[model samples]
Target: MKRILLTGCAGFIGSNFVKTIASEQTDYEFDIIDALTYAGRKETIQEELNKHSFLQFHHLDIRDSSKIEKLFQERKYEGVIHFAAESHVDNSIKNPNIFVETNVLGTLNLLNASLKLFKENEAFRFVHVSTDEVYGQLTDDEPAFTEENQIKPSSPYSASKASSDLLVQSYYETFGLPTMITRCSNNYGPYQFPEKLIPVMIFKAQAKEKLPVYGDGKNIRDWIYVDDHNKGVWDVFLKGLAGEVYNLGGDSERRNIEVVNIILEHLGRSKELISYVTDRPGHDWRYAMDFSKARKELGWSPTVKFEEGIKKTIDWYLENKTWIEMVKGNNK
Candidate 1:
């Protein structure tokens, strides 16, 4: 069986990717590594691991270079899908140091290990997962960001991601390490951390609490289902040209208020719960992606529509109260 190393398998998108691949592809065996940070929960993936004998889990932080190097030396992985990082924007605003350390330095450690291993193992590939926030804000009339757009990140979180993206591409350029980068729009689905917008609104609205909206709630984003995003990532990892960047989007553009209202409707809540708050510092006004490259080149596009995906997500959270409660309790 092909051996693959997957980082951040206990986090939201990472966990989803693990489940998707385990069910869709039977030829690969996976070794998942996660630190179980506030956003990373083992329960998110415990059931999947129980079902798949080929899946293994390790509790380790990527920032620990010694431990990371030792693991890479021990295992001969044919590929790596890196997803571990400090992703919350609010937390990054409060503390940027961890973002830089984990996203930038941690990525460097992975690249160094890959460099050494790839020299010996010619089949090794590295896929660096990133966010569309690395391109900064866009106006209503502006065309959606493509891979060629200059990086102008607005927040420390995005800046760290941009730094990591650059580092990954640099490895391919300077060291000839086989690498690919993927920048994706907003993702929402099951197992998402409660701190994100959709889940936060779902949790608060269920409790009949005020759902806070930043600014006038006019900030726009392109939302992609986690499953679709993960599928696109896997496609790119398998078929994309080395050193290329692919953007994945849902093609569903909606304002923040619209998203909140949709969640309210799905949960049978009221608009009266909507509370407009001060906008965040360096908040991007809009984010959209032209994923034609991914669609045309990789034969990948989003399969889930927002309307259907959001309802499914709401239902998942409603049905799996224990999972959300565990995540909330651990975060506290």
Candidate 2:
């Protein structure tokens, strides 16, 4: 069986990807490494681990370079899907140090380890997952970001991610380490940490508590379903050219207010629960991605519509109340 190393497999997108791939593909085995951060939960991926003999979970932080290097030296991974990072923008703003350490330095450690391992296995591929926010904010009428867009990150989180992206590209350019980068739009789906917009709204609205809206609630984002994004990532990993970057998007653009209103309607809650709050420092006005390259090259397109995905997401949270509560409790 082909061995694949997946970091952050206990987190939202990583967990979803693990579950989906484990169910769909039987040829490859997975070695999942997660730090079990506030946003990551072992319970989220327990079912997949229990069901799939191909899946193994390791409680290891990517920031630990010695351990990371030792793992690469011990077992040769055919591919590496890197998803471990400090991802919250607000948390990054509060303390950018961890973001730099995890996203930048951690990525460097992985690249170094991969470089050593790649020498032994010539066909090794490294897939670095990133965000569209690395393109910085967009004007109301500005065109969506493409692979050609210059990196101009607006927040500490995006800055750290951008640094990592550049590092990955440099590895491919300098050492010819087979690497591909994928930048995806905002992702929303089941098992998402409740601090994000969709889940936060759902949690607060369910409790009849005030749903805080950052800024005037007019900020826009191109939201991709987490499953769709993960599928795109898998497509890029299998088919993409080395050193190339692919953007993945749902092609669904919606304003912050519109999303909140939709959740209220879904829960039969009042709009009075909506409360406008001060905008975050360096908040990006909008983020949209042009993923035609991924469609044309990888033959991949998002299958879920926003309305359908949103409802499904809401229903998931409603049904998985214990899961969400446990995650929230751990985060606290």
The lDDT values for all models are 0.93, 0.93
Model 2 deviation from native, Cα RMSD in Å: 1.1
lDDT of 2 at 83: 92
Report the number of clashing residue pairs per model: 0, 0
- Candidate 1 lDDT, 4-102, residue by residue in tens: 899998999999998877545789989999989889998888888898888999899999999999999898788999999999999999999999999
Off by over 4 Å in 1: none
Give me the overall lDDT of model 1.
0.93
Ten contiguous residues with the weakest lDDT in model 1:
17-26
The list of candidate 2 runs beyond 4 A from truth reads none
